[model samples]
Target: MTAWIILPVSLSTFSITGIWIVYAMAVMNHHVCPVENWVYNDSCSDDTAKHGYPKSCCTLNDVPLISKCGTYPPESCLFSLIGNLGAFMVVLICVLRYSQVLEQSHRSWVNTTALIAGCTNAAGLIIVGNFQVDYAKSLHYIGAGVAFPAGLLFVCLQCVLTYHIAATTLDLWMAHVRVTLSALALISLVFSGIFFIHDSFLLQHLAAVCEWIFVIDILIFYGTFAYEFGGISRDTIVTAIQHASSRACKSPGSSSTSTHLHCNPEGITMI
Candidate 1:
């Protein structure tokens, strides 16, 4: 069985589950108000008199955005840990994807661009996790600024590459799925950005919801990679490593056996 499929699965599952857990922790600790409460209240105000709770419970700063959800003590640590590990997995997956595309098709700059965008997104995620919005507002916004667009670009580029290299009906369908996902992600991002700038509490809440949709859409897109990755075998990774070694050897002219390091491309799958 191919083990590479585990990468995307683990990434999506861990990140999605981890973020929701952070949200729950924030709610339980009164760090943030529950998202459901936004439906009933159109304004961010003192909920103490209404809910018969303390004045510190569910204030304006406590809106349940993902960043806000993880802004507090214990959950913030988990958030940072998740971001670091998720970023590592994202880098590994993007590298494997680039190598796979290189082996399966004529090497193109699009694949390389996508790899860069993925890495940038991962870097932004790291910053977002480590720099809490409440504590480090500027750094957190900078990270978000980098992450959102880069992630959208990566998914869109992957959609194009998927169509370009498609060999079967399933590949075409997967490409279509990716396109739809990227489109929705773009729309959600735009709405989130526009609403986020508004001063109204309701608009800001909607913006937060849109942000959630955008993030979850990106995670789902990553999960789709598992379908293609299922075709990969141990030999695929070995060949990619050998090919890199061969290129390194050829560049420096240090070894005569560089020519013999050429791997059989036949082992690479179209998917």
Candidate 2:
């Protein structure tokens, strides 16, 4: 059985799930989108009539996933930033320790992509949150504009890594699949970039679609972690092959007699 990947995986999962929960909370709370239409003042001008809105909406995003469904948007500063920050801390710790997982496989890409996305998302939020600008085109909006795409790119990178793990049929083909799937993310990102640069709605749509895809990607990646950490009984053919290869290399008269390795639980060994 492989060493436990439980701690880090669990922590990261909880962190992400918390954010999701917050989004759900925001959506259901006021029953109307908090930002569909509004005036320059912190008030919505004839909001319901103007936007044909039902008059209320909000989300927990806890920050990021706020219901696009309108303007006194319910903000969950508590969960949005503080909770996610705490979660990010846990995830960062795990990534630091487990970053080198799958030394012989493509796990490094997953780890790197995750680190980039999570760190950038959290950091970007921190900066935006502190800007004291809550209006449209405010510093927060600009920050989000920058951070969102970076996060998406890293997320696409994550999807690639996840696909690699999922399609790993005892060969390197999995990595190729990962790369291929990630290309879509890349394309979406590029289009989003072009749209944003030109200030087009096409970018917005692409981002929305990609956000859902990224979420799905996260879930798939979660399954990989679950197998790696929670379900110790499962073993990938790749890991087995690597193990066999290692044993073969360690045979008497081989050149590796001077080297020894111990299973380190904290180390997320991909191979």
Candidate 3:
């Protein structure tokens, strides 16, 4: 079995990939088929038979997600092949590299929760990667599952848990630092939450806010990873992170830090 860290990171990476696929399809003037119809274009579209209720034609809702996605055609798959494969490979690489660290790292409820979220996401990817992908498009059914944990539950936990982790540990400075940082991470979480509730990414489809939520969650995620790694890997994090395909975080970005976990040498910034 893979280590605990692998699970959360996998969830994050996979969810990000799902988002990327959707974003790409949208940009290409394609849309994910909500219904599941795979016949390219609106050619095979059958409205009366699709939804229980009959419609003029298969609007996006009528088309099957198994096949239809947005407005694009099957050729979109040829375009997204490279990016899709690469994202999966990256997920594999991250787990392999951190396998050792996860073995001996401290276990926490937050970590467990993140794992659960990741597994759910992985299941979704399996669908997108295997049966349903039209080039790079994903159903987001998987992405939403993963996002619930990292973007919602886990990010919140990082605050209280980081504070608790900090306060209880031998290092007073680190504890205080965690307390402050975790507190601040709450802010990002708030905006991210609002975006999702409204289905807007601070723009259209506020739900797309999920992209940044995970991005911010990663900072805190990295911090937790650092704590799990014990000594921390200054090198692994310093590199520029592309994040998920949908949206990329800024360079030299810090993962989510709670408002509470502030100060100390190993501050949230380090994450």
TM-score of each: 0.84, 0.47, 0.36
Ranking by TM-score: 1, 2, 3
lDDT per residue as tens, model 1, 140-178 = 999999989999999999999999989999999999999
lDDT of each: 0.84, 0.45, 0.39
* Stretches > 4 Å off in candidate 2: 1-4, 7-16, 30-53, 56-75, 78-83, 86-94, 97-118, 128-168, 171-177, 191-207, 215-271
Ranking by lDDT: 1, 2, 3
lDDT of 2 by residue, 205-258 (tens): 444445545544433333344343433332343443454455565677655334
List the candidate 1 regions with Cα displacement exceeding 4 Å: 39-58, 238-271
TM-score of candidate 2 on Cα atoms, chains taken together = 0.47
In order, what is each prediction's RMSD in angstroms?
A: 4.9, 9.8, 16.0
Give lDDT: candidate 1, residue 19.
Answer: 93
The better candidate by lDDT, 1 or 2, is 1
Worst 10 residues of 2 by lDDT: 58-67
Model 1 quality (TM-score): 0.84
Best by the lDDT measure: 1
Q: Per-residue lDDT for 145-216 in model 3, tens only?
A: 443343344334434444444434554555555455445555654554565444221232222333344444
Q: Could you tell me how far off, in angstroms, the CA of residue 170 lies in candidate 1 after the best superposition?
A: 0.9
